[model samples]
Target: MSEKQETPEQRRERLRQEEGRGNPAGDMNDAANRASNGSLVDLTGSLGWKGTGILALFMVLAFIIYAVFFR
Candidate 1:
């Protein structure tokens, strides 16, 4: 018998497979939750369209300031 160490990605995939076996819709919800709450710019949770619009406005203002003042 041989043993192999499972990487984090492999572990997640295995767990997802196990989770899917029980409830199909649950797997989709789990994926949506993870995607919404993941570390890189969570868009769906607290950062709704209003926050996104504000952020975009700030970005555009910064760009205008940079072009007018710095360059």
Candidate 2:
């Protein structure tokens, strides 16, 4: 009898398949839903609105500053 252990790739593939069968990107989906990936890094749903608002505010503030000081 020959002994052949499962390769790392095989194990990973099996685990991935099981993951798909069970939850289909469950952890990633959960992390995204929970806003766990951070706003600066991913900004997916975590910082979208806030980031946009901040950017708009900064732009308006910069324009006002430039109009007052530079122009």
**Highest lDDT scorer:** 1
Q: In candidate 1, list every pair of residues with a backbone clash.
A: none
RMSD score of candidate 2 (Å): 13.3
lDDT of 1 by residue, 1-71 (tens): 11258754456557668879899898788778877776434442256668878888998999999999998
lDDT of 1 at 45: 28
Write one digit per residue (lDDT tens) for candidate 2, span 1-71.
12258654456556656776777678567557648545333332344677768877988999999999997
- Clash count of each predicted structure: 0, 0
Candidate with maximal TM-score: 1
Give the least accurate 10-residue stretch of model 2, judged by summed lDDT: 37-46
Local lDDT at 12 for model 2: 54
